[model samples]
Target: MLTYDVVVPVKLLAEAKTRLSPSLDRSARADLARAFVLDTIDAALAAERVAQVIVVGDLSGHVDEVPAGVVVVAEPEPRSLSAAIRHGIAEARRIAVDERVAGERAGRRSTRSHRGIAVLLGDLPALTPHALDAALGAASRHPLAFMPDAEATGTTLATAAAHTRFEPAFGADSAMLHRALGFHDLSHDVPAPLAERMRRDVDTIDALDAAVRLGLGAHTTAALAAREDRGAPGDHRTDAQPSSRPIDSTRKGAA
Candidate 1:
């Protein structure tokens, strides 16, 4: 049975995707941020095993606009990405506990079926629903699994439950940190899937260019298409705003 829920942590536009500054101007960077948020949610929702797509962070007032089938949870203040993920774990735990106490959910939280949760990075441009499902399908075998970035140097996807002691060090050496947490360390398996066109994240202009160069995931592709259709002119852009307000750490992970 499908084992766990999916948690996606999105960083604020002003604070996230700053490294893309080399290739994209501030406006473009912000646009990419918007696209990333929308795309990640879309991918999460499309996954078959993903019971819930928990968006943990300050939504920048776009919570209502998130694609249908996704759940938005707002953090009241700015917190580290790692903290936000930890919060998601707690929320998933609560769901599991509630379900277990009331009556067991078939695949949602099976005590006999290994419990796992996926912490999906928010900026994946090459992400796809099918690829995500395939990755989770692989993870169903082992209780823990880690899907790293294209470079295999950094981890982009991590699987664990609230009790798994998943400590996230969201900087350099993230892969090692995840391995230390007892995650399945698969570099070539999930990260290198050929059919998975949308797994690359947008942290640099290089990444953005690569995504554009190589096609985008359905969510990212659709978002960009929508943006193009809407036609953001000089002042009509929704991504022009900048805010220093940090992502909140408060736990509001309810459905």
Candidate 2:
């Protein structure tokens, strides 16, 4: 049914979600980052089209927080978002090759099929299994497919067919970049609710509020609940500023 090895790359908590610093403290931001990843992974695992999930990043001190059965690939050297995605894709390829070789050596007819690799952003706190399944199902029809973020300028999810090289261009205006590179935009193909929820990648206070309204993952919900319990302000309204600009968290020491 077109299963995929989903790859999610996350930056260290200490360096993540810096753009929200004006509204959230360091510890709160870290908790939110961890919650986002946990929720993202959980949703990906729950998707029917997902075969495996690979988390690539410097999560040494936080490995235990990840759910069981998900694979973790350490990023010893901090690198660009594109580089981290390449590393995760390479690891997925390596595992696939190893399994094929093992099957050949065992003289057993290989039952495993070559599956595509899906790169999912870790900050999609409002992502749902149904939305992910619908997206993946639509993506399977194209050799390369991508969905733009809620603003329609950035990319939130990208998928490449089995055995095909996924040259990711994830930065400012990444949606245009992927389209320029021939990745079909699958944004309109998914269900309306799925498209709306899936594109809501939380980066700013406003986006976080939108995610909360749409229903956040358990980790994010709890994190926000704790903050509310402490009498911390939960208003996510932002001052006049351009929300279209992308938030690049991969820069070294951004926080």
Candidate 3:
């Protein structure tokens, strides 16, 4: 089976999930963002077709810690989502090259199978290993492939095989952009429920509610429960405006 090195990018905590500000305080939003990343990573790590999960961004003071076996790539200066993914892609390529070289020096063929690179958004609190694997299984058929977000206007996953160019267009109307760029859309290839799980990225309160209906990952569930435990301050604003930042495949502050 084809395997993939997945790259997930997060924005600085303070800047993440600002769209949900009216309902949550800055600290709460940060905590929620961190939880989202954790859950997303957990799902990616659990995926059978995934070879490695590379996280990109400065998570200092945001995430308490990441689990072992996951690689953390420092976010590039200027904090562009595209740049972060590109950096991760570079790291993935480097790791692949190093593995091949080491195997050659050992006078034996590499035990690892052919691998591809996939950029997955970090805001999929409800993502599951099965959903991701299903999408990736479809993606493996094409040199370049992408999965659109639940709304079908954005993207959630972008992938490229080892021999192809890894061009990730993930911000603002990303689905259309990827399609225009000739990346195969794998939406119809996965089962409906599993595809919804892969596309359920959270940015707004309504979106979170939708994800909750689908069942969220452990960290995301805990994060929400924590809010209730703390009696969540009186900052609830139902009229909160959506974040004005460029809407990406994931959350608002991905850049």
Candidate 4:
């Protein structure tokens, strides 16, 4: 069994979830974006195989939402999802080195033993611990792996086993890019609800509504409820994947 250091990248709230602008006002979108990252982190931390979580983003505004014990690395300059994830992977390597040194000083086994790196999109508010664990368990068998999003057109998760190169090409057509980069796709055969939960990355109103139907994390649930309480107008009953249209290309960088 391999324990993973899951790295999640969150784009600036102001620039995130732009496609949802039609469904939520700027302020509301920011709130919901914060909720999405917070909820994703919470679920990642709960995964049994996840040993550490490295969040790469400028979360100064949402500092209070980040749980204690999780690592926070500053987002890279120019702010692309791939850059953020690369920074996080660097941080993970640093942490692993430090742990190994500490273990050596204590005359114990290397603390980084059986460790892997996984990049999970911060937009997965519907992701559950069990679903993540299952995905990770499957990923552990491969040196490099990726999971496509619900629409099967984008990537939601990418993984690299210990001692493997962490080359993540996350953006538009990420699924195809990852496949071209030799990452094994884990989307072929996975259990029903687990796979569904893992693939649900909220982007458009339809996607958000789908996640809501699948069950959202506490933060996301509260954010939506707060909007409803404020009498804010938004669509929460839209059908999931109503069209054959792909996710907005402009909203590609960060999951």
* Best model per TM-score: 4
The regions of model 3 sitting more than 4 angstroms off are 62-64, 111-113, 234-255
On a 0 to 100 scale, what is the lDDT of residue 128 in model 4?
A: 92
What's the C-alpha lDDT at position 185 in model 4? 90
- In candidate 2, which residue ranges exceed 4 Å CA deviation? 76-78, 111-113, 232-255
lDDT tens per residue, model 3, 1-255: 899999998888778887775667898888888889999999999999899998999678644579888888789998798889889988888888898899999997974537889999999988999999999999999999999999898899999987788788998889999999999998999999999999888887777777888888998788778777777783322223333333334434362
Q: Please, what is the TM-score per model?
A: 0.76, 0.89, 0.91, 0.93
**Candidates sorted by TM-score, best first:** 4, 3, 2, 1
Judging by lDDT against the true structure, name the best candidate.
4
Worst 10 residues of 2 by lDDT: 246-255
Query: 174-229 in candidate 2: lDDT tens per residue?
Result: 98989999999989999888988788888777677678778888988887777767
The per-residue C-alpha lDDT of model 1 at residue 102 equals: 56
* Candidate-wise lDDT, in order: 0.63, 0.81, 0.84, 0.85
Each model's total of backbone clashes? 8, 0, 0, 0
Every model's Cα RMSD, please?
Answer: 7.4, 3.9, 3.9, 2.4
Candidate 1, residues 152-222: lDDT per residue as tens digits? Answer: 56766777643566555555667677778777865556555532443466564445556665556555565
TM-score of 2: 0.89
* Pairs of colliding residues, candidate 4: none
